[model samples]
Target: MTQTTILPIDALFSRVEAIFLKAGLNAVQAGALARVIVAGERDACKSHGIYRIEGALRTVKAGKVKPDAVPVLDRNEGSAIVKVNAGGGFANPAFELGVPELAARARKLGIAALVINDCTHFSALWPEVEAVTNEGLAGLVMCPSYATVAPTGGNKPLLGTNPFAFGWPRKDTSPYVFDFATSVAARGEIELHRRAGKQLPEGWAIDADGNPTTDPEAALAGAMLPFGGHKGSAIGTMIELLAGIMIGDLTSPEVLDYLGTTTLAPFHGELIIAMSPEAFAKGRPGDPFARAEVLFEAIVGAGARLPSQRRFAARKKSEAEGVSLTAAEIEQLDRLLDKGLDAIA
Candidate 1:
């Protein structure tokens, strides 16, 4: 059953922070992560939102993810390279710091590279890209997870459907944000479909023998196919190299057995690059912002919507009318929140 409940965004953040804190996260840590998570949900990214909170809590309880890990930055002077020692593994907070630091370094050297080791999963790269955009730079992000995808002609899950995000700033229009996982579909979407008892979409995944399957269960046990076949596979491979191999993470076949599971150092890798827009728009640039606006208006005006627009619009509606929840999810939350008389914590 569907149910309606109204929560101001601020209230939602507070509630999430309180819950995380009670779950053993330190106040600062809980608050920081809550901001990241709530923003994802608010932007209609349920896959990276509060839905992840339960998994994070489980990981913390299982001692795989630390609730309060501070990031340690490792940079090479004048080298445009850095490393982040993210304490406590994936789903921890340290990885967030590493992304921007790398972008900044990339800006200084026309190309920068950084690796996040043993850090927590940083939800939705868009939010992180927004950070780079604010710095007036063009940004590219490659974030990899445990292996959950197969190679072009093989099976048994040899790589992650690692997503790639690129952001280019405009003088007038909103930044051009391109964010998509390498797979035909993100695993989280499949996970959600499975949780909702729905079948997988066509061409989304392959069975253990490398044949396509619409059964979510089989897909889970199988491998996700690349988005554009070999092209996507090629891109996925590049992401794995930048995000995994460059960082000394599980590479190639090693990821096959462990992809999609939390036990592995899911923090694996993320590489970011930021370029000064001034480099490209140096001369005779008719207000890049104005140019972008005209292009965006022409496309969206002509029935072509930008990729993230749908979610952004849904979030706006949700914010105005409040988050809509199924009766079951609400009941589950209530039960979790009502555990014992000391639940207020």
Candidate 2:
């Protein structure tokens, strides 16, 4: 078995940015992608970290991603509602361009909604939501993808994993955040399992024939299941309609069924809503943050683990001991960097 290699966070970020810069990304885009990667790594989200680089590169080469994309603010509805046209590229820089404007509007209006279309979501959503919360606001982020999961009680795959994320600021610690797929597992997670030659948990996926399987290879070639049977399917539906359709973009099934498969991540669009707790509550005693503090006290008093608590712990460890990566994964990255444009786009 290959050993894992650990490196300082700074080193990792520098190397990842260099690789992206070689792959048609501008300095700003490279830094944005690098930050997203570091966030996933320090938070122990391996599936969304360096593991996703090759897949991202493939799409860039395929012309599905405009590495030089300049996402534009299409419309501003009042002080709280906005729209972004992402120029059909990665969502990271688009959010970078749009978030500050939307956040400014939110701080003024006490709430804001930014609907984005024509952007591909390749990383975890929590990072974006966390960004909003870190800037002193509550947030929600969600996106739709190609049809790769079956709804409850049906054999055929009818929906995508449909990721949803939420974030809230905290008084004494890091922000509380959670990001999850409505499907039993994310495609990236399944890919990780497959790469490691590991079996999957029960109810995670089905074979091409629509039969349940614990084999990661079969699961990838087939379909992932909804997480909580009908309940998860329902939430997946809401995300598909809200982030996909309501955002004036094609839903997961629509993208696959009509436009057909494009590349690695055909995720069409995303939705982000930010709200200022102070704006709503005026932040008096026992107000929004204080009330939330009371709730947090009760939760921890009951010995409950808060959302992203593990991630926070992992981040602390990474800061002290450096980030770790498998030797094989390191080799892949090194080779990509060495080959340059020929290997990237």
lDDT of 1 by residue, 1-345 (tens): 356566677877887787777777775568767887788778777777777667666656655567766667787676777777766554335545566676677566656666667655656778766667767777888867767789788876877778899887765435778888888987778888999999987988998778889988899888888889899999999987877787776564554344445333354556667777565565865866567678888998899887777666877777787766566656655654555213322
With candidate 1 superimposed using the best TM-score fit, by how many Å does residue 76's alpha carbon deviate from the native? 3.4
lDDT of each: 0.71, 0.83
Q: How many residue pairs clash in each candidate?
A: 8, 0
TM-score of 1: 0.83
lDDT of 2 by residue, 1-345 (tens): 779999899999998888888888877567888899878887787877887777778877766778887788855756567887878877888788889887888889988888888887778888999889888899999888888898876676778888889999987778889888889887778888999999999999988888998999998778889999899999998988888888898788876775466346674888999999988888466578878888888999999978888888999899999998898878978987887557754
Q: What TM-score quantifies how close candidate 2 is to the native fold?
A: 0.88
Q: Tell me the lDDT of model 2 at 67.
A: 84
